[model samples]
Target chain A: MADAVIAAIPPGRHARLIVPRLLQRGEDFTARLLIQHPMETGFRRDDTGKVLPANVIENVVLLFNDELVFRGRVLNALSANPSLSVQLTAQKSGTLSAHWRDQMGNVGSISTEVRVAGA
Target chain B: MPKHAQRRTLLGAVAAAPWWWAAFVGTASAQSSTAGSDALDERVRAAVLVRGGLSLDIPVIVETGTSVPIVLFADPSQLRPGVRVTRLGIIAPKNPRPVALDMELGALMSQARIATNIRLGASQSVTGVALLSDGTVWQQSIAVVLTGSACYDGT
Candidate 1:
């Protein structure tokens, strides 16, 4: 049964963080994040018509320089492997972290180091 | 100004802030009623009553698919002083489940602008609501005409 659940999710980069490697100080840049998950709503039935338990990512948090920049509580309506895009302004170089927590308590995180163009 | 009068004036201003805000943006609050209306309207009214001052950025017409991007945001730049948005919700009434998304904003993340994709079950209104830290609410909505319905999982 555990293997079946694991099989539902593909193996690859379960999480991806997209941020500009270099940016001008005080400039706003777009940061996008993609996480690979089945986002199973638990309402779908298996091949035998048995209902699968709901398992969806419920929490997402983004941090820059250890500061909470974004937090989201996602619902099942989001498509599988959800992607989030938001605007963020940084005045200094720092690390951006993307963290995801699913309903099953599974956690994943990714971080990227960013630098200011001339700073 | 006498000290007692100054204190009274300050208290008066503090007491009137929330009411003033609710009255200033009257549209959402005025239309907010979760009575014996239909399922969709009830959800919209409930969301609106929860909070207001939210806006949905999406096209009026959309091609239904597994992924239809929608943007919901609250601009704190023009907000009244001391107004802080603490939570946001995205409601798609026509879907099998109405609440598409709900977000909690931290102190440093009070200003929210989220870009996410939603699956529309049918042509319907998508609603967004923002709950202020001071117990005030604001809401915004957008109607999308879907050409087709997305596949549901029997939810």
Candidate 2:
């Protein structure tokens, strides 16, 4: 079931991350992450009445400078094209990255530079 | 019996029924909905939950349950020195799987907050549970009414 879902996704961008280009040290800011996927609940049926296998993202992890910041488990109950926003503090300049895996075992990751001034 | 006395008796009966109160009264009364999920129950049982240190932000009424946005925020003042929130969970009582989202936080997080969208199968109460590093759990619940369902298979 997982293999079929992975095959359905088109080749291209699978995720996007939005972070401020610049930040002040010791300041808190919101980082938004959006993933492109159907997030199928497996409870829905196709036009011909076939049950859609659950193909939602299973886990998400956010990291800063190689340090884990936030991790989450995604379930079928989340809406399709899932978007997550988390609050993070700027302690120093580093790299902010996000990685996620779907129930189908497909992995997607994206990273951005976090520039903090006066660190 | 007199007409006024009969009316009073009917009102009293409605107020006296436990189920009626659970259905109408909001907040704590709607906790019974959490019973549908064993994961939620086990977490609640394992922690020391204090009602109201967290706040849930979601509309009281929504036209569709397809993508209802919600935000969970924990009071920073409630945390003692050297203690921080380490985990968070979101539970929708009426969904096929009541446990919607589970998250773990690390030290880099300046605030105990998160925003996301979720699917709701019906108009029901949603609960947010946060676990702190000091073994304290803060919980908050909000009721949401959906005019249309989101998870119906047949559509």
Top candidate when judged by DockQ against the true structure: 2
| All candidates: TM-score | 0.70, 0.79
lDDT of 1 by residue, A1-119 (tens): 99998787643237888988789988878788888887776656777788777777877888888887767754658877888777777677888898877888888899988788776
Interface RMSD, per-candidate values to 1 decimal: 4.9, 4.4
Stretches of candidate 2 above 4 Å error? A1-13, B1-46
lDDT of 1 by residue, B54-148 (tens): 67888788876467888878877746788777766777777776767766666644247778887777888777777776655667778889886
What is candidate 2's CA lDDT for residue B88? 76
Q: Encode model 2's per-residue lDDT on A44-113: one tens digit a residue.
A: 8898888888888887899998898888753557788889899998889888999888877878899988
- Highest TM-score, which number? 2
What is the DockQ score, from 0 to 1, of model 1? 0.28
